[model samples]
Target: MNPSPDLSIIIPTFRREAMLLDAVHSALAVPGLQVEVWVLDDSPEGSARSVIEGLGDPRVTYLLHQPPTGGHPAVLRNRGAQLARAPLLYFLDDDDRALPEALARACAQLSASAAGVLISAPQPFGDDAQRVEEERAYFEQAVAWLAQGPSALRVVARLLFGPALLVCSTCVIRRDAFLATGGFSTTMPVYEDIDFYMRAVRQAGYVAMAEPVVARRVGGPSLISACTRPQMLAAYAESQGQYRRQRGWWEFMALKLWQRLGR
Candidate 1:
């Protein structure tokens, strides 16, 4: 039997066969890391199974939840967490690519800090070069702030106004700590990363690494891209309310208005 894995990389995918295969390969290619790639396939037609079987990698496991779990990846990701055997859990999207030394570096950092979660910056790559460049700069700034150990309020503000640093695919958390936070919110139709990060950082504490460990494939066919404007607006409003409650309504409103006025 294969030895217990040092890290369990959970990838929730649906019908993205080619990208899923590529992600699995990238996870498996991490040098000096004992990793298991768990592909939670929520594909309606079970299309991802063939890709997993085709690779025939022992380190990879393909799980198909029958009757489909709809489009919410949070649900599928939680399911993968339930079956994970490793102590460290890394969530990677089927379309993203982890850098060659990403896992190794993350392992070293987490080992040293023993923090509940480790957040890494992601470099964007796709047809939109300008957007990618802008995203990279944003991530750099966010990581710099995060590395300084800012207060929870500051972190939330950065998340709301600055670039997103704690992307699901770029984060690694201890399995127990993840379960303690009740995993990702299934009710969040979008911005689940932001929701989870807010709670995780508060619950387990976090360490931010500035290196770009993951490559986000921008301009892809994703749930975020497909979300209607109204849907996004509603999600944003809910998130704002959550933050407002934490910071108090007056302070929250004042900060929000100040941000809007570019002050």
Candidate 2:
């Protein structure tokens, strides 16, 4: 049997070939880390099979499903988590790049803290490819928000409206803690990450916030905010309702509307 890897990097990709390649390279390049990188392809016929195969890393596991089911990133994530042999799981977006020392820091934190459930770093990315000065300011502001406190409600609020540092790409979660929250919800097309984080934080009393782990490439095809307001609002409502029944109507409502709107 293969010895369990120290970390499992789960990246759900659709058709982002070049970006996915970059993510794979980053995962491999992170030194001193023994990691298994699983690419859950949501593309028809596993469009990335050849690419992942070319990477030639024994630690890489490439999987393909039918079109629509493959398109569901959340389901892919949960499936990856279920298959992970490691005690720690890191969910990465295909377009993001992991910092070289991220895994090292995460391992250290996990080793030190027995109580922390989720350990996350800041995500520094520009809204667009140009990488403007304003984006830097925004990035700094986002990191500051994540550094503030550890309230599940506050984390949910930031995930929905603020800089979105709570994205799975920058997070390293304890496997059991993630499984306890039932992983990601595949019911919604969007806001699944936020929904997962909210549930995980609510259940796991503490979530660790460390330095930024991934230099995320924002404004991708799958970004929730890239969608129009109506689509976004609809997802918000769906996610809110789901959170309500499981968590509470009041907290769900607060996260869905009131608190997000700064009411």
Best-fitting candidate, scored by TM-score: 1
Q: Which pairs of residues have clashing backbones in candidate 1?
A: none
Residues 1-263 of candidate 2 have per-residue lDDT tens digits of 13767888889888888989998888877677678889999877677899999978898989985554835688889989999998878888888888858666776677567643554654556557565445445656655765676465676665555545556676677888898888888877677777677667677655565577787765545556556788667876776677668877676667667445753
Provide the overall lDDT of each model, using Cα atoms, as 2-decimal numbers: 0.80, 0.72
What is candidate 2's CA lDDT for residue 234? 82
Model 2: how far residue 107 lies from native, Å: 3.0
TM-score of each: 0.87, 0.83
Which ten-residue region of model 1 has the weakest summed lDDT?
A: 254-263
Task: Provide the global lDDT of candidate 1 against the true structure.
Answer: 0.80
lDDT of 1 by residue, 1-263 (tens): 13888888889988888888788888898888788888988887888988798888889988887768688888988898998888888889999988869777987788688578888888899888887888778778778877787765556555665546577877888888899888887776788887787667667877778888888888768888888988877877786777678658886776666546534
RMSD of each: 3.0, 3.2
Q: After superposition, how far is residue 255 of candidate 2 from its true place, in Å?
A: 7.3
In model 1, which regions exceed 4 Å deviation?
160-163, 240-263
Q: Candidate 2, clashing residue pairs? A: 42-70, 122-212
